[model samples]
Target: MSNPGEIAAVIRAVLEALPVDALRAANTAAGESAERIAAATEGTGHDAPREALAHIAEGIERTGEALAGLGEIRERLNAYLAVLVPGVEAMVARPIAGPAGKRPITPPNRRHHLNSVGRKSQVREENTVILPGTDVRGDLDAIRRGEAAWLPDRDRCLVNGRLYGVEVPGTVYPDEGPGLVKLNRSEYKALKGLIEARGDMDSLPSALANNPAVTGADWQRAAEVYEHHKDYRSEDT
Candidate 1:
């Protein structure tokens, strides 16, 4: 993790690099042109300034949109860095454990309930349901068929043999719809690896080190690096 001071400094550099005054100036010019066009139109039916003002407004709107997009990109970048920096720090400080310590972080424990189209009484009353291993085959089929829906608003579910949850919106459920579902701890770790690897493979080591469960001589190397250079920063080019 970056030291708080280093993060602050990077944020300051980002702000300093933004053209706040330029945007303000564009907005001001647009506003002035609009007012002038409005006044000119009051006296004459044909005002050349009206067309100019329209063009100015268009330019201002385009500039505003561009700035908004830049802001969003910057926000997302900052969030990504926040996750990455801490992960890198952890990796550098810790020794690498064998595959045993390499797992995804478990999400917070949340209660999950089943949602049935029929009477609630027909549903299982147990807070936790362990599906039989033999049943896994059929359950997987049912999930493929979209019969069993995972409700994220409620508790997690063991659909088929897999766990699923609706922690984030737009995550496709087994029902072929959008909802969150829980996954087995191992399955979750695998999925996380797939997602993280999509972006950067190098980041994986750091991410693994961040997990508190990671221990042993392997983790010691990461710990040492994190301890020494957690606050290191690079100038933006």
Candidate 2:
């Protein structure tokens, strides 16, 4: 009968203790390698230092991808725990005192690292079906069907829509697109919330762009309007 928040705390603790520690070590190693390469190239005009830097960059990228995959697993585990644990709903519904509830129990640094990984995953997934001059309709259909094998030229698509050229060739679909294509559960939830607020998926991005508070404000307004109309109907009755 663990509370939802308690389950979330446990998940965060488990992730922070192991995966986050490993990720930090990887990041530190990558940083040290980059710094060493930069120092070696301080005076020399040789391409060796540049090549070393490139290798460091690749290692860092790989570490980031690994972290993202781990984070997705952590999230899935947390969701499962919430479903299995009794009294979780009641605990989550009860508000805590002070900023304890406002601030997530998960460490900010760890959360930021996880978010970075999730964002990278999204960019990779979106680019798979969103190449330059791609048949938008067909691509959308492929995405809907969750077909990973249909995409080609995995290296050419934009990363974060900024024209990145780094491409590691192979079957980009790792573990049924876990590391590269599948949307993290939180991402799926956010997308669903946005669509519900905006009336549809097509309108979501625009609504978000035009008003960052679109979902919160619209939901609150909807509740208020419903209550007002309900009161009027009650008076009439």
Candidate 3:
């Protein structure tokens, strides 16, 4: 019912508002963006060079094992004792035992463990001193080499109640057990008084060292042992 001029004008207005290929162009651009993102993610993947990483890990493990072996060797070396018998060559290396006794035992690692055990046994032995039987000579020897203390209490002598002073073998404490030798209440009190009086613990006499007798080198060893056993009193004391 409208005139041709009016109808043409409405058609042109509708066509002008619609853009050609705009939706298709938008979809193409979106697809390209998605593809680019996928490519970037694949390129950044950490899956390459796994063999190199594995090799690095293997090297680290080998290094750790080697270090552990060196540590064992060091421990053995520190605890090794010189050959006491004259003309005997010092052990160049710890001896190793072989299976079925058929193979020659010369493995250093085995010797190292044996030496470690022997060192511990020696220390344990040094901690105990038999009284009365230990004799004056023994007492002097213990003072020089062992962790020895004397409880000369008249009433508490291991043998006769003669109450004569005798140095007995006793553990240094904390590190060493009370063992066969012990300090009586009176002895403990005396020792406490002496140590407390001194400003420097090293000034205390060598007899007071964990041992009654000690070699010259034993002085340093005695100081280290007593420093840990500073709380001298037994529970009852």
Name the lDDT value of residue 40 in candidate 1: 65
Comparing 2 and 3 on TM-score, the stronger one: 2
Candidate closest to the true structure, highest TM-score: 2
Model 3 scores a C-alpha lDDT of 0.30
lDDT (Cα, tens digit) per residue for candidate 1, span 1-237: 457757755764665566644554454445455555666677676757667756765665566555555456556656655574653321111111111113322322222222111112221212222211223335333333222223233332333223443334323223211222323333333223323333233556565536554444423432222222223232341
lDDT of 3 by residue, 1-237 (tens): 356445444444443433222322332233333334445656465654444434433443343334335434434433332212224233332211112012321212221121122212223222322222223333222222211221222211111111112223321121111222333333332233244433244655444545534344443443332333433343365
Q: List model 2 lDDT by residue over 1-237, tens digit each.
A: 467667667765664554544553555455555655677678788888878877766665566556556556766765675576744431222221112223322211221121223223332222211112223333222222211111122322111111112113311112111122223343333433333343333544554435544455444433332222212233244
Candidate 1 to truth, TM: 0.30
Off by over 4 Å in 2: 1-17, 88-237
The TM-scores of all predictions, comma-separated, are 0.30, 0.32, 0.17
How much lDDT does each candidate structure score? 0.38, 0.37, 0.30
The predictions' CA RMSDs to the true structure, in order, are 27.1, 21.9, 37.4
Off by over 4 Å in 3: 1-43, 46-48, 81-237
- Per-residue lDDT, model 2, residue 15, is 49
